[model samples]
Target: MTSAQVEKGSEHTSEEGYERGLGSRQVQMIAIGGAIGVGLFLNAGANIAKAGPSLILMYAVAGVIIFFIMRALGELLLYRPVSGSFAEYSREFLGPFFGYFTGWTYWLLWVVTGMAELTAAAIYIHYWFPDVPQWASALGFLVVLFVANLISVKLFGEIEFWFSMIKVTALIGMIVIGLGVLTFGFSAAGDTAAVSNLWAFDGFFPKGIGSSLMTLQGVMFAYLAVELVGVTAGESENPEKTLPKAINTLPWRIGLFYVGALTVILCVVKWTEFAPGVSPFVKAFAMIGIPAGAGIVNFVVLTAALSSCNSGMYSTGRMLRTLADSGEAPKAFNKLSVTKTPALAITVSVLFMGIGVVLNYIVPEKAFGYVVSVATAAGIWTWLMILISHVRYRRAVEAGRLPASSFPAPGGSKGSYVAIVFLLFVTGLIAYDSESRVCLYVMAGWAVALGIGWAVLKARNPQIAERREPEFEKV
Candidate 1:
């Protein structure tokens, strides 16, 4: 294909009947909520046991890399903002096959991630109602989020905005309380709380660098849904203004939510006090002698879980519709409800997400860990596609094949290259860790499944195999 043909296909695709209902405030909160999840609230304790104070550094480093990834995505959104986001860019820059693979893989990522979130929410609810069954709680949460998503993009955005607000407000409160304890020594544990707690237990890097490095896989997992902002492009009221503003604030969000909050918590309660499967925030609050502290933190973490799962419901439906529009999925998926929401698409994804409730019933103990690893692995693939596509778009611009993005990524393609290498190294780390290795195995099976689907698709509809060249206009 000629450069002009490539350029033509690169222009933004029209929003396929989606209402631009998400406003700037809701979009900003969605970005914040994406960065904070059960990963930080629940999983950080386990990582601290493995990496000690060094887990803070892991989050900071991963945060920077996430910033780069968002910048790369921001550049692309300005070029062609679509609800499809990564999959659309993959189709335009890479080919039809890559696009199909990306769309389905992303759908799988959210579906499984939704399961993980539901499982987490169930566990949190148990803290309040020990008598309730885990499966019932999971099913209850799934239905609630599914209905919210089915209403309208506006309703989904509003629910997410408040869910995120609770998480952000709680973290800030925890940080402020911890700092007061350190500076004034007023709380019960204030006498023991000290900055030295970070290294006093076993010295920094207490578990060794290799142990700390292994935590990267989990750290990256905590940062999984941050890219959900890019998926909101088509429904964003002002993609050019809102998307960049949201992406630019990622550094602050990571620094405050992940690194800052962890620092204060570790200082308040030594790393040794943290253990796998417990929330460090809850532990710190209990240590500080705050009345009903653990319960409050549990409520906040519960919101975090619901927030991420809410996002899963929203994105999975849009992604399925994107696939349907491209003929990769059933045509019925592309239909819009009276509310302008993808009702059929959302319903199908919710049914798949309900499997999480089943897993909770069958293997409550193992459900979260099993689904989280697979979601992290799928997430890595999605990020890689975005970077690879960004690099190709940059090259196209250089060759005069396309126009430059208004929000050009800083360091241009080099940043994408560095982020790509970082992701590959993290993948290697996943393979190195025995526990996480299962995700790679699962991903292998997923790849084979998609490969067979692609072959069948090509055989059935030869035109589906051909890339449709659309006309492009400079942004």
Candidate 2:
């Protein structure tokens, strides 16, 4: 790489190493697009069915906790911005082993998340091409997005920008059309859009808090990519200004996209009508007799799946590079393309994600459920590691061992403490679930596997212990 490549993607920038190819608009939209994914577009129907209309409240509550989590992460980013972000922070504060584990766990999380999303993508494709096999759909989307990420980060940002715009537009349209039907009785939904539908069936907590809590596993999964903003910090132009701007808008996005959209959905179609496999967005439009409802929602959900796979490729590539720089992964995984994209790392991750396609052939019926449960556990592990590292970071600051963060976490360590407990409660709820008990099994297996891998790497590369982080952007 040339010195200019390190300094900036364009002549107007100053970061020395990374392309800094992602403009502020791209970063802002990437944050928005990241927060809204297949979880909301696809898995949400199942959650609403479990919790009834009260799922709105559940999502709002989860949003608040997630906000706190983001705040802690935001503070960390301003402390020291790097593509490796949390993995570096975890290494610096928690321990090398914990950092190594966090990077791989995040990598694993997105691998499965991509798989789970492709599982949903297959179903969406089936909407248009009924005769095509699910595996074919999964493979097709995987290849397309893999090629996209290979081109350049700028191209990736462009793709994500439009992907996010589609999601935001879909949600806004739903809300407006839903309200019109509710107040003016304009649509063919026939008074089905009334807000009273939230309670008309069997009251707000139709299935009780137990059922709602049981769905927390998936609910938390919907919030999985909310921290992706941190991942983009390294490549982002003007991160000092753009990073905070992106992170600050999250609360509104959560309220508007998740809480508001779902509330509008339940208002349009009673909870009883929403089935586990159905997209509530499609169902809402169909209720109003919109002829292209299914097709429109299918397109949106398809983009959501692709968007997730796109992000999965992006994050895993960066993380593998981090692990490689840290001497935890194969050094070749760190190689970048001419466009400065981690082509090798991204291609490797995409190849692994295609496992989802193969699994569809082997067990088409239960693939999404099983893989999603595993992804949920992996997501929780990543978040837990982030919090643990942040706690340690807070202590170091308080003790004057490290300088105070430019953007300190709100409520300081107390917020992290509360968020940790909340995450544990959600994990406990997953264990309590008979269907989701497999997540615990998966987590145990992953831990053992990662431990074994670490041992092997340590023996193979003892020099890694003596290695220092490269002064340039190692990510």
Best by TM-score: 1
Candidates' RMSD to native: 3.2, 3.1
For 168-193, candidate 1 gives per-residue lDDT tens digits of: 99999999999999999988898899
Model 2: worst 10 consecutive residues (lDDT sum): 1-10
C-alpha TM-scores of all predictions? 0.96, 0.95
lDDT of 2 by residue, 1-475 (tens): 2333433543443342457789999899989988888888888989988999888988898898898888889888877777888888878777777888889989998999999989999988888788999998898889999999999889999999999899889878878888778878876885666888999999999999889878878888999998888998778876777888998999999999999999888887889999888788877787888779768878998898888888999999989888887889898987777788778889889889989999988998788998899988988887887788789879978998666766788889888889899999998888888889988998898899989988898799776544244233354
Candidate 1 deviant stretches above 4 angstroms: 1-14, 470-475
The list of candidate 2 runs beyond 4 A from truth reads: 1-16, 463-475
Predicted structure 1, TM vs. truth: 0.96
RMSD of 1: 3.2
The lDDT for every candidate, in the order shown, is 0.90, 0.84
Q: Candidate 1: lDDT over CA atoms?
A: 0.90
lDDT for model 2 comes to 0.84
Residue pair clashes in candidate 1: 8-472
